[model samples]
Target: MTTALTLTTGQDQDGAPVLVAAGEIDMSNAERFTAALSEAITDRREPLVVDLTAVEYLDSAGLAALFHHADRIEVVTGPLLSPLLAVSGLADLTTVRTR
Candidate 1:
């Protein structure tokens, strides 16, 4: 079965666009994740903050989605997912912080 995921849009303290995601991001829902990122990026036209602290799993497809939008986004994830982001080389392309 496909894993559960939720994507919510909002603004940060500085009024920058933010996309808060919860649950797993795998091939089953990677497309939806990418679409959300695309929408946030297109609508805001600025660096979007992606909050993934509550996400439990992210597969290669999810990573690919992030890479596709690497230039226009920052990532905030928990320690569990930090190493994956760093090892995926996404940390080099954009800002990724662990919380």
Candidate 2:
């Protein structure tokens, strides 16, 4: 079963786009996350900043979604690391900034 993933959007002081995601991102819900990101970038024409601080887990499907849109999005996460991106070897390919 696909768990519900929470996605929130906001802008920085300079109008930079930001998306805050809080939930598990696995095969079941990867599409939902991708759709949310697609919506965030549609028409707005701004680089996306994804805050994965509250994300507890991530999987290959989630990484694929991010890779598909790697050029348009920047990812930021909290210190506690999850091996999903690292194991997928996308930590360097995408804009994943850890805090």
lDDT of each: 0.94, 0.80
lDDT of 2 by residue, 1-99 (tens): 444679999887879888888978888888989998888874567678888888888777888888888888888887664355666666777777887
Candidate 1 matches the true fold with a TM-score of: 0.93
lDDT of 1: 0.94
Off by over 4 Å in 1: 1-3, 43-45
State TM-scores per candidate. 0.93, 0.81
Model 1 C-alpha lDDT per residue in residues 2-97, reported as the tens digit of each score: 559999999999899999999999998999999999998845666999999999999999999999999999999999999999999999999999
RMSD of each: 1.5, 2.5
Q: What pairs collide in candidate 1?
A: none
| Steric clash count of candidate 2 | 0
Best by lDDT: 1
